[model samples]
Target: MVPWSLWEKLTTAPWLSINAAGQFVQWFNHLLMLIPFGAVIAVALGISLIRRRWWSAVAAVVIPMVAYSLNIWELFIEQLGWWLLIWLISFALCRTATHYLMLSTTCLKIANRCQFFWPLYVGLCSIVIFHPSWLVGVASALIALIPTFICQRLRLFAQLPSKPLEQAQMLGANKAQRMQWVAKRWLTPRLQNWRARTLQQSLLYCAFAGMIGLPGLGQHFYQGLSQGQHAMVGQTILTLLLLQLLLWSIDHAHKEVL
Candidate 1:
């Protein structure tokens, strides 16, 4: 069994300082990591909103807001406003992209087939890129996510009954018109379930990217393990478990709402 003094030293040593301000600053820096972490869910929520999944959107927004309310609220109120703006921008961008993709069969086909070798692509990029930067992390995460996104979209597209497209075509609807009509009538509704699942999967991928230098809990956890900092490792594990619980609650709430 560990002595109380030793446990205290283990837990507090990382933040121990003679100056109070310095200790506070260290804590603040650690909490700042939540911004990007929360942004993942925010971006996912934005995409879900674009796909017209209102319930999942609500869950996504509320879960993070509640989960990090204590630590993140005091970190930067103004930055929260910036995040909201970012969410709005993402919403507009996704909506426009979806509109354009629906209008162009060539673009849709390209998107479907472009990332066929995503696993190889991710591995090659990770191997070649030795330096760790936010750009590298973002690029890696996006590379891994794009294929999953396309597959989810295609799966939804397949489940769509052919009757609506056929009916639209029968009425002399052009290719674009049929595509748009089917998208609105069928694809959007079915997208809610998959969007929620995708958001969960995206969180996992984002966390995994931390091992490759993505900032946040995962990165800190990896560093702690490498440095043999038991306290830091334990803290990160606890934080990650809390995060997982929050996500599960959000997912459960989303299911009930549906």
Candidate 2:
């Protein structure tokens, strides 16, 4: 390991230069690290889309609350009820706020970045100060999904034709059955594409999470840059190239499905 003091005096840092195999490994590692994050985001989006509105809001709040509760447990040492109370208050505020903001793009942006507002919340808990954990990634990824739920709900509201419900009623299709069929037909493809993109967004959010003291390449990259380790930063950028390739492939896959 390079000492921080030694790093400061070094004439040149060598890790900046990576070979083809090394680059491949870096990209693969970063992607692998984020796959769980992508999966979590996908599930959260699916639930929000299907459950709709207030339920979706509750799902988004619960994810981070559970995460924060566990982190708090390590600090409070048996105050589960206290932490739960705090989270419930938060959920009430979020629900009321969601009711007002509803469908705006600004609301969407705020939801996806909800944790960004409480970035310091993690720091308040003593357990997270010295340790980095995957729990943070899961919590943050889920927390970031608030905007996705809001956006998907509003998108469905706009896209679903009023004609289908009326026509289905005339055809003797009950409300639940018609909604099931109509929503499936119209929203499946869009949701599939959205899921793929959401995965990418979750990964990017993880990078930002990394900067804010979570464990992963984002933090690693931030630390390297802070220490003036250009080589390490270079590796992180290459990993980003890999992410772009994956995203390109996902986009093409969506088109093919369409």
Question: Best TM-score goes to which candidate?
Answer: 1
Give the alpha carbon lDDT tens digit for every residue of 169-235 in model 1. 7788788767766665665554555533333343334333333332344455556777999876665
TM-score for each predicted model, relative to the true structure: 0.40, 0.28
**Backbone collision tally, model 1:** 0
> What residue pairs are clashing in model 1?
none
Kindly list the per-residue Cα lDDT of model 2 for residues 46-75, writing each as its tens digit.
544554534543443454344344442121
lDDT, residue 167, model 2: 75
The per-residue C-alpha lDDT of model 2 at residue 97 equals 51
Give the Cα lDDT of each candidate.
Answer: 0.52, 0.46
Model 2: CA > 4 A from native = 1-151, 158-161, 164-216, 247-258
Model 2 alpha-carbon miss at residue 80, Å: 35
Per-residue lDDT, model 2, residue 219, is 57
